[model samples]
Target: MVQNPERRTVLADAAIEVLARDGARGLTFRAVDREAGVPAGTASNYFANRNALLTQAAERIHVRLRPDDATIAAMARSRPAPSPEVLERELTAMYHRLAVQQIDYLALLELRLEAIRRPEIRAALTATMRANLEQNVAAHRESGLPGSDVDVVLMYLALSWLIIENLTLPGVLEGYDADRLIAALTDLVAGR
Candidate 1:
């Protein structure tokens, strides 16, 4: 069957919504169709099976949730060769934005959890995540951010964990200033 890219994208987007709201277990062809407000069997036509749908949803979440070019450009422009202070500021802003989009992050977390039991899904997610990390490393290099590839990877992991924790458990770390924390992290990652 000839694939319709637009229709596939729409279905995948709807699947992401369902995954975010209802989780992996709740994600079914019917649920996606209903979420998409499409007729029954529409999701089935686009995805061959549950795994395909899940994989597509994971891919869509990454695509839809990634920061736009403007934001990236702004970050790059924040500093010619970002010092620890500048890196901390950029990371703080990024974390705040992620907190604001908590649901999308939560959906990604759900995908990760689902992948734990499914090797194929795990492999797909791992590949996507590695590609994302490589892209981050490249961006850091191109933008002259302070850090080696390993440092960049470490920074990404730390920031992601901190963002997840902060979003999931609001006010849990109230005594500590996030900016200060990020500054310390930036210093550590940059080996300053």
Candidate 2:
């Protein structure tokens, strides 16, 4: 189980870059090999297949979210209330960053579509989405919001999809600025 962590990180980073730049349609073993500056055989040896490589890349992403396991557990158990204003501000800033830099979202969206055709990808995507929803619900509960606030998580998820959908739709958000959407999401989260 012990291997060069650096090499594995490189492979994962390269795979993410390839997925972002080329979409799922262009993710290939050869492309990842080139991006990572590793031999094609090396990628094949590590990944075994395109799906394996993509799954690993997605796992790498899942490791880096703001509320990790510790945070999620604390939120689930803590009774202390947090100000939604701060969370709203943080969430808005994050969404703004994602929309402006769009690589991660594009990669995620591409993978999501690919998942529709692949069971493994679908499972991974479903798990990730569920985890995020659960995390958001935990945060809301910790912030003194009642457990009946399921709509908070639903709104959060819907607004996220709306941001991506607006970007994906032809000419829909061309005239609109990202800050506006970020503000709207913030307001939604704050129950304004």
Candidate 3:
């Protein structure tokens, strides 16, 4: 109901923090307000209800996780397509970014679980996720990136779990060298 876009985004970001910190059941307008350090009813003004807030929070997480324009431009500017070795560095760097952004990744994981119980949330997220993956695949094809579409998907799945373990339970991957693992993934992508 609030007309201020900035205020709404602030509330949405606060909602992400609440979702990550307390999970879905604990995400209330009051909780978001508390997290945002706003007045008791401020979140109510921005969000009609919990579902609206949750969807907005999911979108905000996507915005946060997306690579910036500069990064995108650089990827495009590599000229004549980067090599499979470059793909290794690219995927490794991407994994590092995801791992370091602990809160955003954890909040996204929370949303995925919540989606299982709430179809609306699933619907809201599915389109955005599908589009993103499509864009990734399209870009890989257009850029002539060394990996195939299947390779991209494989890296997506593999890196996601790697990041999850790195954030949620670092000990699980403690002894394995990250560089070697990324090299192996790259090898898989190159079909070598």
Candidate 4:
């Protein structure tokens, strides 16, 4: 069947919402359809089965979570030559914005965990994450951020863990302020 990109996107977004609220086992065409407020079987029309829905939902989460080009451009314009401090500020701001969207991140975490039980989903998610990492590295380079690709990769891993922990278990790092933590991360990435 011919796919409707717009409808598929809508269904996938609904699937993410379901996955976030109900985890992988709870995701179903009916649940997605309900979440989307579409008629019954609408999600099925877009996705062949649960796995396809899961994969599409994972892709949608990645797309929805990334910073837009305009935001990136504004950040790039903020500093002609991005210094360590500038990079730190930008990274902190970006992560803070992400922190506010806790549900989306929670859904992503759910998807990652779900992938562990499904090898096919795991492989697809790994590829998607690798692509995202590469794209982030290229964006950092283009914006003149102070980091090599390897540095960016490491920073990405650290930031991902930090964000996940901060969102999932608030006050776990009670002694450290967000800015101070981000500063340390910035210094680490900058090799200071």
Collision count for each candidate, in order: 0, 0, 0, 0
Task: Choose 2 or 4, whichever is better by lDDT.
Answer: 4
TM-scores for every candidate against the unseen true structure: 0.89, 0.75, 0.93, 0.93
Model 4 TM-score, 2 decimals: 0.93
Error of 3 at 60 (Å): 1.8
lDDT of 2 by residue, 54-151 (tens): 77776665554344567557545753455555555555655654455456667777778888898888887788877877877776665664323665
Kindly report the root-mean-square deviation of model 1 from the true structure over all alpha carbons. Answer: 1.9
lDDT tens per residue, model 3, 1-192: 778988999998898888888888899999999999999999998888888888888778888888899988976677445788778888888888878888788888888887888787888778667777888788778776688898788778898889888888989998997778999988878865
Candidate 1 versus the native: TM-score? 0.89
Please list all clashing residue pairs in model 3, or write none if there are none: none
Candidate 1 local lDDT, 1-192, one digit each (tens): 329899899888888788878888899999989988989999998888999888877777767768998977775566655576677777888777777777678788888998999877787788888888888899778767677888888888888888888877868887877778888888887778
- What are the runs in model 3 whose C-alpha is more than 4 Å off? 78-80
lDDT of 3 at 19: 83
Model 2 residue pairs with clashes: none
